[model samples]
Target chain A: MAENRLDIRYVAHLARLALTPDEETKLSAQLGNILGYIEKLKQPDVAGVEPTAHAVPLINVTRPDAVGVSLSQEEALRNAPASASGLFIVPKIVE
Target chain B: MLHRLTISDLAAKLARREVSAREIMQSCLDQIARVDGRIHAFISHDAEDALAQADAADRELTRGVAGKPLLGIPIALKDVLAVKNQPLHCGSKILDGFISPYDATVVEKLRAAGAIVFGRLNMDEFAMGSSTENSAFGPTRNPWDIERIPGGSSGGSAAAVAADECIASLGSDTGGSIRQPAALCGVVGLKPTYGRVSRYGLVAFASSLDQIGPLAKTVSDAATLLGAMSGHDPRDSTSVPQPVPDYGAALTGIKGIKIGLPAEYMIGGLDPEAKAAVDTAVKKLAGLGAEIVDISLPHTDYAVATYYIIATAEASANLARFDGVRYGARVEGADLAEMYCGTRGAGFGPEVKRRIILGTYVLSSGYYDAYYLRAQKVRTLIRNDFLQAFETVDAIVTPTAPTAAFRIGEKSADPLQMYLSDIFTISCNLAGICGISIPCGFTSAPRLPIGLQLLGKPFGEESILKIAAAFEQDTAWHGQKPPL
Candidate 1:
């Protein structure tokens, strides 16, 4: 668990949040508490338990071979905050 | 006339032409206008479009065309589902102005079946909380008791069905969002087998666990809705290619059927009143000629921990799409990074942000093996426990939730306590099994509705609905309506 305020800021940055000063203080405490609780799980012993990710026995499930049309460009861009010619408009990336 | 009728009853009326689809749609619109203010069940409604569809259905029926099973039935969808031309806000201020230009696969199926898609209903912001209090719009009050919560993420669908704003509604379940609210609101909720229904346009919360299902007043109504809503959708990769069964045919009789009682679920933390209600339900099932057996699901206690790690990890990745870009509300800033931060920070509710951070931490490089991997192992153990239990019994029965609906704002401050509310329902999703929650009885304390859950194996909805229908027939629990 992170202890210093700076370390907390680092983790918050990783999460993409720009925390306010008060939020930094409050979240540091809350995250520390949560980490402390999570530490309890480390105590459980399992000498050779293989890590399991999926619950059911499943392989890649595929649909039938059929052609289907996807949403049109106009439909896809209907909800965009800003759009150019058949594309979503975002802040310019290049200098 | 349509307000008090069940889906099956309304379908019968439509088939006989005793009432036109337009008439039923009008009744639903009138009911929504009357009760939606106090209930807050709907987020968006298109009366003109719905009436137009109803008119089309009526025209088809007049030409001696039967249309489809759900023809002319008015249904409300959770806002999480995409409906073309409607603002699918998903109960968040961030997506407040976002409108879907295409329908979700299920929405398209419903429309094709001639069902009048009435409107989008309210829900927990991004389906993150057990109570609709997490909704950015506002918390949906329980119709039964205005002071208590209508157990959520699917609270809007549950309350809408309970208040008769719609005969049936579609809600997605990721750890009992559908069943918990349905149980509290005195309705029938189903969570189909993981691959049984499509997740194409569900607005992914926990991709593996999320499934859209139905909530209705009767078991048969839920079955009818499920049959029409399910099938192989090429658009949804996880959808099964198997033929959709006639769910109505399965509800006939449960004579000499086997029902398992998972003893672990009946132990400590279960309200005594809830236990008594379940006990009475067991007796009723036995009287209907079904054999009840005490069974074991050993790893039930670890369900919540395992569920959080997996669900949160997926949520963290799934929610990454919401940075101030393509659609929805965006908070702008001078730099790209700041824009992303500002938008997410303002758009998401507190619980959603908390889960995302927790998920990110678990999946982080240093903690991956310890938190995320270990939880996955435990999740396997949980699934195995259910598989082992199924070998000895056809279906497992337990209380849907530990207690009935709590007062709104009661557990909002304590996130851990709120997570535990999903303890009983989470395991079903983990195991990739199907389950249903129906009103069994009422708690004596505040007289809130208590739900009885039945878990079945993969594609075992037919068996589960049979048992639920039997229970419904033997008792008047489903008939009792909340006085709004």
Candidate 2:
């Protein structure tokens, strides 16, 4: 449809999502259809236009540094799937 | 019929001692029990807690608490907004069994207003999709016609309001999520200007576009909810600092207001019945002594494409926080990378996965300029188009969706077709303006509700609400309930 079929495995890997074979096949086709629709923008001339990240222009918003109520460690990790010793747990990364 | 009372009616009755908060709560609970079996609008509701809150509201009412506007009204929260101690699943398997440790800012505001917040309604995962069909939990059937879909990802919110499961509900709109479903289900849905309401607790879908607003049975009811929920929150920097007006007071006849009809919104392929309804609405506006000017938003066609790029890119970044370590359901593996991959692989639904991949692809090296940046630039042009049109018109009018609610699974197979379902509503989000969808008319064959969307200038909700209220006052659409 476009230049090249999306490297579904590559993009999924970059997104840190593990997809099964069936999902990859189904998604590739769906994405291809969406991208083709998006290609319609080629007809518009958007040169020299500022990219809008938000609806309104935002400046660097800063607040005065002050101490305030902070969540207790237990409250912070209340929803953690695995935790030990007042901290969130994850699979061992270092051997 | 306590469940059928408008928020204002309920508040007035509670103040006059004509009804107690507990009585109203019981009535809603009973209604839910009788109807929810077929509607499934709710994911989970704590009846005991809801009643407890109602009891507390009664105590406050007896104690002569001066003025708590929504002191005892039952309001449903779309699953994405985190309510303290409530399971915030966001209609996704990824976050199942997770309880919110704290209330989102909106939840805090609602509690302060004395509203009895209850029930987490169903939605498309992360507020994606045009229909509730994208929910990992089964789709929420339309209350209007059970065989048809409740437009989504705020489908459940609209259904609950239409079916009187809750007096009014809060829903988040990223791109027609609030209004489309409200339109299809025959209720009033408002997507406030992007920053008018705080986004402190709304689960991020597309950060720039996502906004939290109200869905209610009437324009005034929607106004009541908005007044209570609006204001600047330090928790959300984007929350506008301007004083929140008494939106309810703003409701009045549009005696001589200027309205615009954007020609671009009325192109061919629009459903003929919907077109007729909007045309009639324009005539009615003219009859009300309102000036109707023909306007143009030339860049309308590029909105869907621009939205997909910007929303997907932002969504990819926001959803990255869902890795297994912090919270949510997890899958274990030998290593950290494997754990992340395994959990995400299993957790996210197909539609979610497709979006993440598309987003990632657009933001990837070498493609950033070609896709993401171009879309943003085009987004500015679209915004400019609206700003120019607003110079003469107080607000613009259009169909909320191209058609009435279609049958469930109708567009599920074609994602592109589903994306186009929001064609008329997407530009408002891109421009960061406010909009509302009110039941304007209906289609006869299967008898589905149609909506008239009013687009307002940034923070110009009062203008649209007044126009909508006036239109609503003269019309009978807002009063028509689903046959259910």
Candidate 3:
């Protein structure tokens, strides 16, 4: 069995996910199993191996800085959960 | 019956002026209405809009505009892609009610080729699960056996094609999402070499791993779709600037090509029937005058482990944009933090939440080096293993999945077991190469379809397509349809 190193509640908090009691219990067990499986990564001798972020090498992919057709404000706001006068509405942040 | 025709067949008929695009669209809509209740291949489709597009295609055909390959074809898209004025749900509740204002690059290309695109097909939430059971809407059942899963997260794409609900469809493969489902549902699916198809409007699951490809009735059909879809898009910088090759012209034969059978893939856990099918496929290729060489991808065992860490870590960062403030569903709470937590807690399904948490755990400050960084380094080893094997062989052959489609609920309870469902197909994505799954054979009594996988080097899609087309030509497996 793989050792349980995952702190479910803490991780959930970091991910901005509020978990129910039932979900907390289930996720704790399932993620433990997955982490145990992931422990296999330690076995590979990856000493001095360069980490590959992208499979195909991409460097300095720049295009001409010119204006192009852009989405209208109405179109951008069309799908927002709450919008008023072209601005998306979010829960209050200031106390 | 027109809906049952492959893209190539439909194209030939349309060119001969024997059929109109509207008729083809009607035929597909009829099929979807007929079998979709059982297969659940589509989340939703706009019949009126599809027919309108088809009518326009007919008008274009009347003008004698020839040479467009996908012209008059009715294609569906997995729900993960953004289609203009269409709902863009990644089979998750978080994206409910969200409609894209613009088409994805692949969708634009398909439109340019004159395809009548409609339907938001089902998939695993955020392209996360091996079985479509994780979809927030519902699971897409296999056409072969309604009780079993259509391998995911491209389940709906593969299932729709198998049931003749669409001429063909586009699917995004992050792990085995495209190939595994194609194997289970008995269709042709290809994951183009990474960056071969631009990911401009694909809802990001794992940015580095996500790729858009095709699922179709035959290898030639897949080749047609890939040709229409492949190109460099200035919008997606990761897209390769290499000129697109005419893949159809490369389907001559594999007379002198050397195909490799990796020893690591024939593991003990592989279903005996699947092994037999692949063994026979190798022999058939050998008989076709292709050399069969034994090869080893030594780091194969670590693939699933490497994939889980890197994919989930990337997903954690990518999916962070789904806060309730911007678009889609929202849940109210007291403050900004509470709203974010509450919305995510309510919106995401079990699998999505589990992965997000797992991803967050790996990328957290203290554990970053131990988990995410190590996994990335190990990924280098996995990629090297394939590069080393490709040195002596032009392509590699294996079973697309370890077994045929299992029951819908069979592995859903155990996330680890579900993760293992992708063991055979995940490494291809990790290696950033092209691969295809074609129907090879079927299991007896309560029969299910099995698939033969062909892997090609980066940008070597033509070689694998040639091999797949040849194998498909000499065999009757691709001709068999489900009892549906």
Candidate 4:
């Protein structure tokens, strides 16, 4: 594993995920193997190469912010696991 | 027999008034009832809804609304695509209770073309895995041999087509998901050029890499579906504004085309028999007057590694919208943060979680340049490699997968091994080129099907589709059905 390879717990935390202890151990080894193999990218000196964000490039794709027929509140909220009064509900913060 | 008919054939029958649309729907429904119990290709489908649409289509035909392509044909969609008022599981526990409020652009087009749109085929959770084993709902068994895996995340789509459950099915390809399974299942699959089809309402995996395409029994049927499904949509910002050509008309003799065979794709883990089949396919192409030349895609070895980094990085960001506060299944927690964690942790499958971890690590502080940025730079070189090669050859040919479909548990334990198998398929996505897999031959011992892949330049579906149609028409491989 690379010396600076990320800790599995830290990665899960950053991604807002929670893993059991066994999952953490297994994932650490798995992720370590993946990152170790990725060290091959270092062989090429891409000092001046511009990164490709899109495969077939797109440039300045924007549309006017006009209101169109959008999903109604009832339709959108129908799939919500927890909703009340036409709004999504989640656990409370700020006690 | 109706299910066995291609979309083109079925459309012709509908126009001739030889069969009612309801009869076509009943044939698909009967086939599903007969075989889907063992294959498990569909996650969900409504017979009543399908029959209802078919009855309406029959009425339209009676009223002189005929000759529309794909009319009264039944098509299955990979679970990832949204069909209005239908359950959109996406083969995961996360979106278990969710129902799509509107149709995907493709689904809307299918309805307008008078096709019965119903079945939600199983897939790798969020289209992540090479084998459907990663699905939270159980793996889809290969129709060819019940013990083997159907190559995924479009395994169900491939299997459904092979089993004659639907006239055709749509599958999204990121890294050989559509083609590999299509090859393994003895079916025809086409991954259209990136942006050839709009991605509107398709669940995002790696948005930049994802392309929706077709899997069917014949190349003409795939072409028929692609022509109807593809076009620019304001709903998808990345959709190219180019007009979709009549792909069926592109089918012609391949007398003078130049085809490049990358020497690398034949080596390494490729089974000898599978390799021989592709070699035979190359000979066939050459005999048809296509100039077959040896070409080197020097960066072939690095595609898997590069794909893992770029695809996962994008996935980690794309999946962030699935937190518990909004729609989708959620688990209760004391605080807002806990709710988000609990929901995702329980809802996602192991492979999905692993990718999320891998993705988050690469994009985080201290390692972003080492992994994410470096991978993107390497991605450019891979694309450039293909672009340079296309100048010499009109298309490139290779084996769709390293070997025939392995047993279900074969590579599931090792993430690296699973990721490595995507080698031949991933580069096409990285380069944003079109590719297709047609049944070339089968392995002798296992009797498993092998796929021959022909990749095209950007927006060059016409060239590859023409070549595939020619090869398919001459060979009996695509006509052979699995013993169900």
Question: Global lDDT of each model?
Answer: 0.85, 0.92, 0.92, 0.90
Candidate 4, after superposition: displacement of residue B270 in Å?
A: 0.8
TM-score of 2: 0.99
TM-scores across all candidates?
0.95, 0.99, 0.99, 0.98
In candidate 1, which residue pairs get closer than 3 Å at backbone N, Cα or C atoms, i.e. clash? none
Q: Model 2, B361-461: lDDT tens per residue?
A: 99988788888998999999999999999999999999999999999999999999999999999999999999999999999988899999999999999
Candidate 3 chain B has its poorest 10 consecutive residues by lDDT at: B440-449
Model 4: per-residue Cα lDDT over B74-102, one tens digit each:
88899999999998888899997888999
Off by over 4 Å in 1: A1-8, A22-52, A55-58, A62-67
lDDT for B220 in candidate 4 is: 89
| TM-score of candidate 4 to 2 decimals | 0.98
Clashes of each: 0, 0, 0, 0
Point out where model 4 deviates above 4 Å.
A1-4
Interface-residue RMSD per candidate?
2.7, 1.7, 1.9, 1.6
Q: For all candidates, state DockQ relative to the true structure.
A: 0.44, 0.73, 0.73, 0.71
Q: How does residue B40 of candidate 2 score in lDDT? A: 85
